[model samples]
Target chain A: MIEVKNLVKTYGDKRAVAGISFKANDGEILGFLGPNGAGKSTTMNILTGYLSSTSGEAYINGHDILEDPIAAKREIGYLPEFPPLYLDMTVKEYLYFVYELRGCRLPRNTHLKEICELVKIDNVYNRRINNLSKGYKQRVGLAQALVGNPNVLILDEPTVGLDPKQIIEIRTLIKKLGKNHTVILSSHILSEVQAVCDRIVVINQGKIVADDTADNLSRELTADHKLIARIDGPKDEVIKLVQTIPGVVSIVADMQRERGVWEYNIEAVEGTDIRRELNRRLMSRNWYILGLRSSELSLEDIFLKLTMGESVNEFLADKADDLEERYKEEE
Target chain B: MNAILKREIRAYFDSLIGYIYITAFFAGSGILFSVSSLQYGSTDMSGMYSGLFYILLVLIPILTMRTLSEEKRQKTDQLLLTAPISLTSLVLGKFVAAMLIYSIGVCMTIVYATVVSFFGAVSWLTVFGNVVGLLLLGAAYIAVGMLISSLTENQVIAAIGGFAAMLVLYLISAIATIIPVDWIARIFTELSFAERYSPFTYGVFDFSNVLFFISATVIFLFLTIRVLERRRWS
Candidate 1:
């Protein structure tokens, strides 16, 4: 188990990591999702004992990172954003170095061989690190972290530069690793985190905006009774008709779907289902309801809503304004 | 510490720096020995040993430049710092590795002394004294170079900075002589490495000089550890 309490790191006058706290239970894969420049890497660095936090305490398996660094560090396997590798050494030589560096007590040869096979870098085992491709280098870095088999594995942007195939392979490997180790993975890609992590922590500007399982986050943050309708009618008339329906809070013709048909994003008041009323009004006015669906927020939408500090209503309003500007430009 | 020491020693040989350092030290000392003693048929090897001191100023930087700076540049310091090792061991490991390679080069001087003894009656006692003094002086120089290396990530900057530091220490006594203030010059003279190192060449084995070199090495090594620890906070 890993726990961080009110961790803050500041560089000069800039607060890189504001006070943020979270915990990762045993055998859990916790994904840290954020845009670039968020404190994901900084927090991971502090957790790994690489950088000291300004105010708070980080504990690895009950040992405080600052107070008992050696024991705390012994429990963590960290792969930073950039894999820390010695380019001059071969994969075999580099792994051996890390093995000894971590003071691993396991049988050295068999333990290293198993890690290489697990990460699928056994083919390139004898090649010098500088000669391998980026994906292989990353895997070798992962292999180095896996050498000591520490209880906690902290990986920062592990799949940042891999190809799609390699990305899937690494994701699968991480899923397997999570079965036995508490893995904290950080990434900017929303889908990758949603696909691989058991829980997601969305961070924005050095603060935890939301933290829960991906399903729970989406369920809790879904916009209040929203519906998306594709209407085949005059744009101005459709907007006016949808406005007349009761319980409809707002309506915006968002995007042109098929020439004259446009997708309208409709928001209703809380606990109100306006889908049937919206369809009846549009059809009574001879506006064809080409398609209709309840708008449930995806992980991406929840991520943006949390990070951008914009509610769903304001977000649609901004889109409607942009659409109006485009219409004026065309005229 | 042992792991880092082994890897650092192996790293020196894996690249051309180790070969270049050994070759330069051997060639420079060989030429100096042949010119100062062999050509003159003089068995007094003190002149040869003293002349090699200048050669060390140039080579020490080359040996110690990449000890810590390259680790920072390649971002491999993360691996080292995150490993379950104390900062003291990390610093000491690199220091000892550089010193080991330097000792290999300094030990080659014994070969030159052995060759000289074949022709003339050589004083083994003075030669042993000079060897011990040279090793102690090299330890101090390596520590200073490693300290500068720890301050920067650019290998070129580390090398140039190490050279500049070595130059200041080499000329500190001369720089002190030019100062008119008596008390300040005396302090500078007291700090001068050259002032303390000259007695070893003349067969004067002073316990104080040995203490000076050992203390200088320890002090610099300690400061290097402090720099590394300070970086984590920064």
Candidate 2:
């Protein structure tokens, strides 16, 4: 387990990490989501005792990283953004060196055998690290971190430059590792974090904006009900009819998907379900209701909304206005 | 500390830098022995070690250039510093590893001493004094190079800086002669490592000179540790 309290890292005039704090519980996968240069790496570095924070405390298993680094570091296995590997050494040599360097009390042969198997790097164990592919090099880096079997793993952008197949492989490995070790993974890739992390902490400009589960974050950020309806009716008449319905906040007609069919996105009052009433109204008006469905903000939308600090309704309004302006130009 | 020492030693041999350094060092010492003792047909090895002193001006840089600089350039310091070992032990581990390699190279010069003894009577005490002096002086030089290496990530800069620093220390006695004042000249001469080491080459193992070499090595090693600690703050 790890805990950071009001951690601040300032580089002279600029602050790289400005008073941010979060925790990764035991056997949990905590994703640090942020754009590039959002202090994610800085936070990870401070946690791993690689870089000192300007102020505040980071504790690993009740030991402060600064005051008691050796004890604190003993509980951590860190893989920096650029894996710290000696390319001249082979994979087995590098991991063995790390094993001895961390002062592992376990039998070296059995311990290394297990790590090589867990990260599935046995095939490249004899090859020089620099001679391997980037994916294999990353696996060796992961193997280095697992040498001592530390309780916590701090991985900074573990899948930054890997190919799609390698990314999925590494993600699967991390998910498997999460069954025992507490993991704090940082990345700018949204879907990667959404796929593997149990809890998400969104950081922006050295500040934590939102901290919740993936589902909880999107659900909490969504404040209004949304519905998409496909109806065979005149566009203007449909818009006017939807506006007349109570609890309907706004309606925008989407581009026609089929001949004589109009799609409209409807925003209703919070906690309101106007789909049934609207469907009945459209049917009574002799408009064929081809499709109707309820919708909510996606994780991508929630991330952009919270980080950009823009209201969803305002964004949609601007988008609709832009579409209408283009239509007028085309006319 | 042991892990770092083993790895550095293994790295040196694996990458062929150890063999190159040892071969280069012995070649330099062989050239010096041929000129100083063999051609002259003298059994005294003091002059040969004196010649070795100059060879060390270049060899020490090569020996220590990659000790810390390569770690920085390759970003391996992140792994080392984040491990459970203390920084003092890390720096000391590197210092001892360099010393061990340098000692092995210096020990090979004993064969020259053995060859000299076959021709005539060679003073074992004189050989002992020069060996001690060489080790002490070489340790100080390695420490200087290690400190310089910690200042930059580029091995070239570290090597050149280390050579320049060693050259200045080697020439301190000569530079002292050009001083205008008596007191200043005396201070420069006292500060000259060459002045301290000259007595040992004459087969005199002065305790003060031994202390001088040791304290210089310790000071520089301490400086290297301070540089490492300061890096974390900056």
Candidate 3:
């Protein structure tokens, strides 16, 4: 288990990591999702004992990182944003160096061979790291981290630069690693984390804006009931008919789809399903209901909303104001 | 520490810098030895030892420049720092690696001394004393160069900075002679590495000078550890 309490790191006047606290249970893959300049890398560095925090305590398996650094570091295998590589050394030589550097007690040859095979770099093991492709280099870096078999693996942007196939392969590997190790992976890519992580901590501007399972976060942020409908009728008539339906709170003609067919965005009262009611009302008027679907926000929209510092209520209010302006212009 | 020591030593041999440094040391000392001792058929090797000291001012930087700086530049310091090793061991490992390479060049001087013994009466005491003194002095210089290397990520800057720093230490006695104030000049003379190093060439085994070189090496190594530790907090 890893726990961080009120960790803060400041560089001069700029606060890079501002008093963030969280915990990762054993055998859990926790993803740190953030944009550039967020404190994901800084926090990872501190956790790995590479950088000291200004005022806080980080514990790895009950040993405080600052007070008992050697023990804490012994449990962590870190792959920084840029994989620290000795370009002059071959893959085999580099892994051996890291193996000795970490003071691994396991049988050296078998351990290294297993890691090389696990990362699928056994073919390129004899080549110098400088000659390998980016994907191979990243695998070698991951292989470096796996040498000592530390219980906690801290990876920063592990798939920042890779082809889609390689990215998937790495993601699969991470998922496999997550079964046994407490892996903390940081990435700016939302789907990567959503696909691989058991839980996510969404950080923005040096603070965590949201933390929960991906499904929980999606469910929590998407509480406001909204629907999209395409109707074959006069735009104003469709809007007027949709607003009169019971439990329908607001309706706006979003955009014209085709000749006399307009797509409308409608909001309803909480816990109300407006789809059936709106469909019945529109069909009763002989206005064709071309298509209708509830607009549940995706994780991408939630990510933007949380990071941009715009709450869901504020977003809905902005849309309401836009609707009011459009109505006034028509009048 | 052993792992780091082994890797650094291997790295020295893996790149051309280590070969160039040792070859240059031998070549530079050969030219000086031939001109000062062999060409004149002089039995005294003190003048040739002094010339090797000057050659060290140029060659030591080449040996020590990339020790720590290249680790930072390539981000390999991340691997070293994050490993379960103390800062002292990390610094000492690299310090010892550079000293070992330098010792290889210093050891060749013994062969030169033996060669001279064939031609005429050679003071083995003075030659042995000079070898010990040179090793001690080279340790101090390597420590200083390694300290400068830890302060920057650019190898070129580390090399130039190490050269400049060693040059100051080499000329400090001459610099003292030019100073107007008596007490300040005396202090400069006291601090001059060359001033302390010259006595061993004459077979004077000054215990205090040995202590001085050892202490300088220890102090610089300590400061290098501090620099690395300070980087983590910063």
Candidate 4:
């Protein structure tokens, strides 16, 4: 278990992580969601006892980070933003060094073999760390963290640059580890977190805006929300007609796809689903309904909402390009 | 602590740094030894001991430049610092590793002393005292160099800084002659290493000199521990 209380971190004049607090239960995989520079890494650094908190305190399994650093550190395994590696040494040598540094008492011969099999990096054990691929390097780093069988594993952006297959493998690995150890993973990829994490904490501007299970936060944030779309007739005419409807508050013609086809996001006044009525109206006008899709508030949309959807184009309607562009701008 | 010490020792031999470091020290000391003991046919073994002191200035940096600086550069300190070990253990481990390199190199030079004793009349007790003093002096300088290595992440800066520091210690011995030997200056001059080491070269055992070298080594090592410990807190 981990407890963070009133944590605040200031870099120079700018406040990076404002006073924020949260806790992760034992044997739970808690996901920390945020855009770039949202104090996710800074919070992980402090929790791992790598950096000192400016005002608050963090306890790892009841050991205060500052007071009992060695004991606290003994229970925690950390993989920072950059994987700490010694390029000159082979993977086997590096892991042995970390194992020894952690003061592991297990007989080295058997313990290292068990760990190698657990992380599944046995084939590349003899290869120099500098020669391994990026995905392999990440695994070596994870293997190092698992050296002492630490109770709490604090990983920051674990699956950032891995390919899709590698990402799934790592996520599966984390899920398996979560059953025995308390894990805290920070990532911008929502589906990845939603797929594996037991609980989720959404932070923005160094503050926890929403903290709950993935499903509960998704359901609560988008209560009674429905997206209505009518395909056919002129989009402007559709907008004008929707305005006459009793519940419709605003109609926006957002896209003009080749020729006469047009689309708009029409929001109703009070979280009402007007898709049935709107579809009937368009059918009566002799307009053919091409397609209409409602945007479900997945963990991705909730992540954007909690982070303050300032630049996320609502008209794009789940377009990944806009999300990627927004992710870059935040960095 | 033993793990880190073993790893550091392995790195020296694995990467050829241990070989290079020892080779350079032996090679440099060999040339000087051949000139003083063999070619000159000098019966004075203590004079050869004086020449060996200069090797400390050059070789100490080679043995210690990468001790902490390379760890920071490669981000390997992340592994060591986060481990359950204390900072004192880490610093002490590296200090012992560097001293091992110095000890190995100095041991090989023993063959020279053996050759000289067979050929000439030399005070074996004085030579033994000189070797002990040399080890103490090398240890004190290694402490200073290791501390400087921990302060910076750049290996080049660490190496140059270590070299410059050793240079200052070397100059401490001659500083009194250039400056006046006055009452105030006299105190600083007496604390210099050369003044302290002079008694041993004359075949006299001085408790004060031995105490001075031991004190210097302990103080610098304490400072090294302090600097590393402070890096963790704030």
True contacts kept of 3: 0.82
Where does model 2 sit among the CAPRI classes?
Answer: medium
* Per-residue alpha-carbon lDDT of candidate 4 for residues A147-175, written as tens digits (9 for 90 to 100): 87899999988887688998888899999
lDDT tens string, model 2, A118-211? 8889998899998998888887888888888999999989987788987998899999999999999998877788889999999888999899
Give the range where candidate 4 chain A is weakest over 10 consecutive residues by summed lDDT: A312-321
Residue-level lDDT of model 3, residues A1-331, one tens digit each, is 9999999999998999999999999999999988889899999999999999999999999989899999999999999999999999999889989988899999999999999888899999899999999989888888898888999999999997788998998999999999999999999877788889999998877888898997786566564478888899988878888888888778878778899999887888767887777778878889888887778665556666776654755676577678878876986
- The candidate, 2 or 3, that scores higher on DockQ is 3
lDDT of 2 by residue, B13-55 (tens): 9878789989999898888889889899998777778888888
**Where in model 4 is the C-alpha error above 4 Å?**
A11-14, A221-270, A274-331, B173-184, B197-204
lDDT string for model 1 (B86-198, tens) is 99999999998999999989999899989989999999999999999999999999999999999999888999999999899888999899999999999899888898899
Kindly report the docking quality category of candidate 4. Answer: medium
Itemize residue pairs with steric clashes in candidate 3: none
- What's the C-alpha lDDT at position A231 in model 1? 92
Q: Which of candidates 2 and 3 reaches a greater lDDT?
A: 3
Evaluation by DockQ, superior candidate among 1 and 3? 1
Instruction: Tell me what fraction of the real C-alpha contacts between chains A and B each candidate also makes.
Output: 0.87, 0.85, 0.82, 0.64
Query: Of the candidates shown, which would achieve the greatest DockQ relative to the real structure?
Result: 1
Error of 3 at A180 (Å): 2.4
Instruction: Return the TM-score for each candidate structure.
Output: 0.90, 0.87, 0.87, 0.85
Candidate 3 chain A, which ten residues in sequence have the lowest lDDT sum?
A296-305
DockQ for every model comes to 0.83, 0.73, 0.75, 0.61
What fraction of the genuine interface contacts, i.e. the true contacts, does candidate 1 reproduce? 0.87
Off by over 4 Å in 3: A221-304, A307-311, A316-331
The deviation in Å at residue A209 for candidate 1 is 1.2
Worst 10 residues of 2 chain A by lDDT: A295-304
